[model samples]
Target: MMSCSNERQIITNAGFLAVVASQATAGFLSAIFSIIVLRKCGNLHVHQNCKILIVSMVMLYIVHSVSITILQTTQLIRYLTYYDPCVVGLSTVICFCLRLPASVCTTSFASLLFAIVFERATALWKRGKYDAYGPQLGYALVTISIIVSLASTFWAVQKVEFDQHSVYCSTATSQTADRVMLLCFLISGVNIITLVGIIALFIFNEFALSRREFDLQSSYQLRENAYVIRIMLPLSIFQAICYAIFSISSGLISLFRDKLSPVQHKTLYTTAY
Candidate 1:
């Protein structure tokens, strides 16, 4: 059994390294794109909202990179310490350090995405009416989301505790924490769906307008709307793909953890990384 555990630990370490590499690459790309957008869109008042979203995404990527690094390292430690009691305490500490930051960043990203999508939807459906209240409503929503995220983090910290002897220290027994996590994921998914739908509607509307005899200004507005979709479409796709990869990997790891031997567990973890 001990030999099997040792073998698994080796595999898990390799997986952790892979996750670190992927995350680093993604973070770098996100940061570069964000800088480019900020530089190129400086004079475009029309793209001001998009610029804010881009900045928010950049911030999310930064936090995600740091938190994932800590989480992966701690997971590696947990795997390696299956037979070594001395290292478990350090592993637990690393996990504790990572969890809150990861949750906070995830929550913030979800909130920003929701705001961006909701605002775009309203703009599309109500047309000029959105202009009247968009900024104020967006600000209020973001503020509320942040407050909720912070409060949830505090509550989670109070309810969750480390197990000195176990590798998995998550407070899965806490119903409230689980519910809060579920709510966050639900909100994120809804936001993504809403944004995708709005983008589609905008594209269709632009096509319809192009076929009709519209005023010059109205035609220009349609063109601008199409341009926004072009930029946002790629970003939305990237985010969706990232989320899907993470979710699938996490689900498989959890589902197979109990059935596999220690070495297999480590191998799976490494592959996931």
Candidate 2:
């Protein structure tokens, strides 16, 4: 017969193992999907510029997914060793490993989504002249995203702390950290709005294009652009929805900081995940 403490330890180990296994599975599936998209983009009969942007997005997604999985795996090891499970309470090295990449990945994803919106919008509005500047624009956006996301990462890592009784690491303990979380919520709101607006614009453009007549070559080009957008729109929408849920939850957590128990905070954070 197991003692009480032993039973509790068993439960904790099982929970941590479940989390680690799920994270690993998610990362594997995401990598597989990204690889397929990468290869398919190469073979796609789409504009070269669109292809470049799509492939780049896939690459970023892959990197983000893999980084998150690694972070989770690190947490799993920490639990196995009976170290602090909360990221905030961990040593600086573990803290950096867990938070920095996550911050950068989150911000970069939002930026890349906006960049895609720009590319698709330009293609729809400008029609034929898109290839002239699309790839250049995408590259510039990606570079800028990396820089901005790094800045956000720095801001988010400011005073992370861990509580043994708490559900996870707490970053909103200080006023500055609270402000940083608020900023994240604001950015998330922007992502949702921009994504929704992009979808609306795409629908309008497609309808307008359908009513117009063009030369066979121009029409073919338009169709190709539309095809690319159509294939990518669902992905954009899925990301936007996830972002919306995360952002709204973060905002609520930030707003009701004093009211939420650690378990509530953990639940919200998990939902965001």
Candidate 3:
């Protein structure tokens, strides 16, 4: 004997609960996988680096998933007439908590990928000199990544203002946010190009190394490097595409905010989450 509004409210609550539960589960699983990778790959230097990268990616995804869940749940509650300003406020806070860490982790991952590429290039092209500068390059790349990520965080916070009335939780005024989103898309495109270029170089170096009278171990290592490049290249490309799509969609939403109807707003917010 429930009323129509009551039924809609029940459905909204159920949907929101489901999203939050899924997010929590995903975060838990990611944490467990990160721990396992760290434990199993602790001894080998190469594997240790790989583990660090994997852990960083998992943590980033965990933050994203949790943020989406909070946003969705908050929207659902708001829609179901159980809206509380404080709940909305908390959701915004949680969204930001995830955003900053995710950005930093992504930057760190890109730097790691760049370092690995440089190391491989050095080993193949300047074998005798690699040991002299490989560690130094790695250290420099990681440090630079940290600094860049911090700078980006400061810029985003300063330039973007959170929209309290909008369902989506983000920093930046609508117009400025659109520009920032475009910049992110451009960055992703550049990343994809860089990854592809590195992969091409890797393949060429592998071919050259194979035909030379190099040490057997060196040849084997070159092949391994080629394999890693193959895997990472595709992954990087996929991530770039994902980032581009997200950025473009966000930019469009921000640009058309005033023209969108309530249903359109809800749909867009849901898609974003």
User: Is 2 or 3 the stronger prediction by lDDT?
Assistant: 2
List, residue by residue over 1-273, the lDDT tens digit for candidate 3. 224443344335544445544544564565566566556545533423333444444454555445444544554455455444333323434556645664555555555555556556656665443434334555555566567756765565654444433333444434346445645665666567667767777768667766787766566556656665776677677766766676777777766877975445435643553
Residue 82 CA error for candidate 2 (Å)?
2.7
Compared with the true structure, the alpha-carbon lDDT of candidate 2 equals 0.62
Global lDDT scores for all candidate models: 0.55, 0.62, 0.54
Segments of candidate 3 deviating more than 4 angstroms = 1-25, 43-87, 91-98, 129-134, 161-168, 171-176, 266-270
- Residue pairs with colliding backbones in model 1 are 8-263, 15-270, 19-273
Each candidate structure's TM-score, on Cα atoms with residue i matched to residue i, is 0.67, 0.76, 0.70
TM-score-sorted candidate list, best first? 2, 3, 1
Q: Model 1, residue 48: displacement in angstroms?
A: 3.5
Best by the lDDT measure? 2
Model 2, 54-83: lDDT tens digits are 676778778877776776666556556663
Q: Which candidate leads the pack in TM-score? A: 2
Decoy 2 TM-score against native: 0.76
TM-score result, candidate 1: 0.67
Q: Number of clashes in every candidate structure?
A: 3, 1, 2
Which is the better candidate, 1 or 2, if ranked by TM-score?
Answer: 2
